[model samples]
Target: MPVSLHGQLVVAISARALFDFEAENQVFEAGDDRAYMALQQQRLDEPAPRGVAFSLVEKLLAFNEGGAPQVEVVVLSRNDPISGMRVFRSARHYGLPIERGVFTRGASPWRYLKPLSAQLFLSTNEADVRQALQAGVAAARVMPQAARASAAHPHELRIAFDGDAVLFSDEAEQVFQRDGLAAFQAHETSRAHQPLPAGPFKPVLEALQRLQHSTGGGMKVRTALVTARSAPAHERAIRTLMDWQIEVDEAMFLGGLPKGEFLREFEPDFFFDDQAGHIASAAAHVPAGHVAMGVAAGQG
Candidate 1:
């Protein structure tokens, strides 16, 4: 029999997304691969600080304990193999039981997602994220400067997502982009009974739903739909989820209001949004990932 990732909730994350490697990244950006590798080599023994997604990873990994392992977090990084030593050491220092990795030097690591059977891919690089999404893997470009998850929930994994271009298609977003808010609301209102199309992160939500159902007695998963649509427009988003048979623990239709304070209250381990402005606002209050999809992502 061969080893398999089948039936396991696999997550692939980059070193930069999982740890605070900004200083090293600055050096790598300023210099060449040689300089970055040398610097990483020099700091091999020093454990890196927790990055924005650290809390999310930590909570997700908790599901593996006290039973059959249901979750696997793999390092899918662009760092050279030499630099990977520090990544492993940092994980160990933080007590994260991550044992697998794919270090591609300066090359893109998205190619390994298929072999790993990864359900989700998180990285600091937008290009890699875009490529992963194209390959049908749920992927997000992590906002490195985003605020870390709060320490309020230890045994629960709380995840949040935006509606359009995230869990739902960018059709409404396209209308909003083409016309104005009035037109967008009217469009959604007309199609309130119809289910909105699944967006890039829909697969991830489905996977999370499975994880939430399968895991027993150790760690629990809670999901939320936090969007900027309110009232009549909100009905369509709710109906879409209902049609998909996906149930989120909470839903917020903030309309045009700023999402930061509401997210701070939610204290999600991580949040994903397609729009950069929403991501920027949410990042100030919660760990956020940008799904670079649809018209908003195509914009500057």
Candidate 2:
């Protein structure tokens, strides 16, 4: 018999996204692979600190506590095999059950997302994240130095996402950015009942929904849709979700207000936004990921 991950919610993450490797990454960035390898080898037994996406991964993995296999997390990274030892050591140190990894030794690792059937890919490397997104996988460039998630929700995984260009197509956002607010509102008003197209992070949300329903005993999953659209425009967004038969626990149609303070109140384990400004705002309050797509692609 062959092994299968067909019914699982699989997530592929980079070594840097899962653990703090910024110091060592600096050496590699300076074009000295030998020094980087030596440094990693020297610190092989020392566990690395948790990075931006750690809490999210930890909470999601909790679903498989009794080995039910509802979730799968793979370390898909460009680190060399030697550095991968440090990653494994760090995972063990933190009591994470991560047991699979692919160290490409400086090569881009996004290609492996296909075989792994990854619903989500989180990495600090923008190019790798871009590749993953281009390949039709849900990906986000996680902020390595962002604040960790709030520990208040110990038994639940809370996630938040932007609306246009994130959970839905950037069509509406393009209209907003190019034609301004009044035109955008009018356009959405005409399409109030039409469901928007799915964006890069839609698969991630779908998988999270599956993980949330697969088991009833572990940490549960709660999600939110945080967008700048309000009023009649907001009606289209809600109608779109209803059209798809998907319901988020919360929805904030902030119009043009800053999302930082509102996100601080929600205290999500992680937040995903396409706009760099929104990422900047959210990063200050909670861990954030930059979904590099749509009108906001180049900035982040």
lDDT of each: 0.91, 0.90
Clashing pairs in 2: none
RMSD of each candidate relative to the true structure: 1.4, 1.2
TM-score of 1: 0.96
61-163: candidate 1 lDDT, tens digit per residue? 8887777877889999999999999999999999999999999988988999999999899999999999998898888999999999999988889999999
Q: For residues 38-129, could you state the per-residue lDDT of candidate 2 as single tens digits? A: 99999998899889999998998889887568888999999999999999999999999899999999899999999998889999999998
Worst 10 residues of 2 by lDDT: 210-219
| TM-scores, one per candidate | 0.96, 0.97
How far out, in Å, is residue 128 in model 2? 0.9
> Residue 101's C-alpha lDDT in candidate 1?
97
